[model samples]
Target: MRKLQQRLDKIKDNNQAADALAGRRSEVKPESASPVAPERSRGRRRGWLIVLGMVVFGFVFGELALTVQGWSGPDFSDARRVGKATVVSCERRGPIGWGIGYWDQCTADVVWDGGFSGRYAIDRRNFFHADEVGTTVTIGEGAGSRGGGVVFSRPELPHRPAVVALGWGLAVIASIPILLLLGGTFVAARDAIRGVSKR
Candidate 1:
């Protein structure tokens, strides 16, 4: 009987040991199989998103700044006549890498009546009137024609509505990409922040 009792006690201890080991394995498994890999991948994607957003913003909007500056100049409507000049050459200038057809710029080089010469830039309003080489155009100087930048003018200013509407439509269409890029970047950043807080 004593021998049987000893055997029973040994079996009980073995069962208890097995139970303890199983509990420990359950705890360890949760830790080892934790969902950490996906979190790391998400972090990497968010980092890339922010970086790409900034680069695209700088590249696209920076070019817009330059384009606006180039298109603007002093008003010569009230200026006195400096001299008459002959159109030497015709060329076009605009922002590079994007918005090619949306924005228009036409420039001409002219030789002044007094044996002097300089390049003249015209805005979109006068782009259609870009003169041919050797054509005569008037030059107007700012501040009563005393000393300032010159402006070029043509004899006739024709009104064309179709070209103006086309330019406006193209400009509106070009803005879509910029809006989408910025919106996507903002959403990605917000999601990343929310994920971090949850953790």
Candidate 2:
């Protein structure tokens, strides 16, 4: 009977040790080990974030491309020809990601006095006051080959090549914070996943 009681005591001691260990583990484990949201919710959130990052990156890349073009484009005095340009056609293109928020692409063809013609693409909002087929607009002079010698009729929007380049240079500064935020989120998510895996 004594041996049986001792055996029961040992069993009880083992259970007590296990319970204490479980309590310690609960205290030591961090809530962050798991995702902040459910796995499904996290995946959705990450998908949205990736899309946001990609869209923003595309804009930034385009801006920088324009900036570089402006920087490398030739002086305005060498314009091959300058005069009234008749708009042949204008196309509005948009609808991204399941056709949501498609307010971005516009391109028009302008034929100048010398029969010189070129395509002008404008991503900015309302680049031309009255850009449409058969519209008469003045050809922008001094635009290097980068701009395809095309310029918007709206003067304020098209700055000097140097100024355009400088503006983009400065604009890139603002993207730093956004990039950091994206990077941090990615790192946090990765770490959370890693932590879960370690368990």
Candidate 3:
């Protein structure tokens, strides 16, 4: 009978030790589950969201500006034809990822009215013209010019009008994400305000 009572006491002691350990663990859980952790997590997510929205906004806005410029081109109304120039080199650098050509560059040797002579780079958003070396290309100057003045092709190279349309379409499509992000931010802000008012 004494041995049986001792056995019962041993079992009770083991259970109490287990209960105390579990109590310690339970006490530790509240600190681990701090409300600040969730707030920090939300802050990080909001920061990332804001960064993404800015990137999208900048990209779309830049593309829109470029599209407008490409369609309208430069103000050539005041430009005048200079003279014939010998094609030194011609290159088309563009069409990154898929087939979107960027710009056309043409180098030519020409002399200005002021007796200035040198090779000039005719860089513009113009269609690629396969001009061979030694080819005679018509060149021109803009209205106000100085110091390696504004030189361009007499008949500006042709650009794909479809590209402007494509750019507009892509911009509109990309804007959907911006709108969603903005809307989400607005809703989140509204909810936070309401939560603060309630508190």
Top candidate (TM-score): 3
For candidate 3, lDDT tens digit of each residue in 111-182? 765577677776554522445467776555664445445535355643345665766676676577677777
lDDT of 1 at 80: 47
Task: Report how far residue 166 has shifted in candidate 2, in Å.
Answer: 5.5
lDDT of 3: 0.63
Off by over 4 Å in 2: 1-75, 78-83, 86-109, 113-127, 130-137, 141-162
Q: For model 1, name the residue pairs that clash.
A: none
Q: Count the backbone clashes (under 3 Å) in each candidate.
A: 0, 2, 0
Model 3: residues >4 Å from true position, as ranges?
1-28, 31-33, 75-77, 95-100, 111-117, 127-134, 144-153, 156-199
**lDDT score at residue 132, model 1, on the 0-100 scale:** 53
Tell me the lDDT of candidate 2: 0.58
Question: What's the ranking of the predictions by TM-score, best on top?
Answer: 3, 1, 2
Error of 3 at 105 (Å): 1.9
Residues 93-164 of candidate 2: C-alpha lDDT, one tens digit per residue: 343331223333455576666677777665544444334556665545555346664444343344356755
Candidate 2 weakest lDDT stretch, 10 residues: 95-104
lDDT of each: 0.57, 0.58, 0.63
Please tell me which predicted candidate would have the highest lDDT against the true structure: 3
Model 3 residue 44 CA deviation in Å:
1.5
List, residue by residue over 114-159, the lDDT tens digit for candidate 1: 5676676555433333445566656554452355544443334322
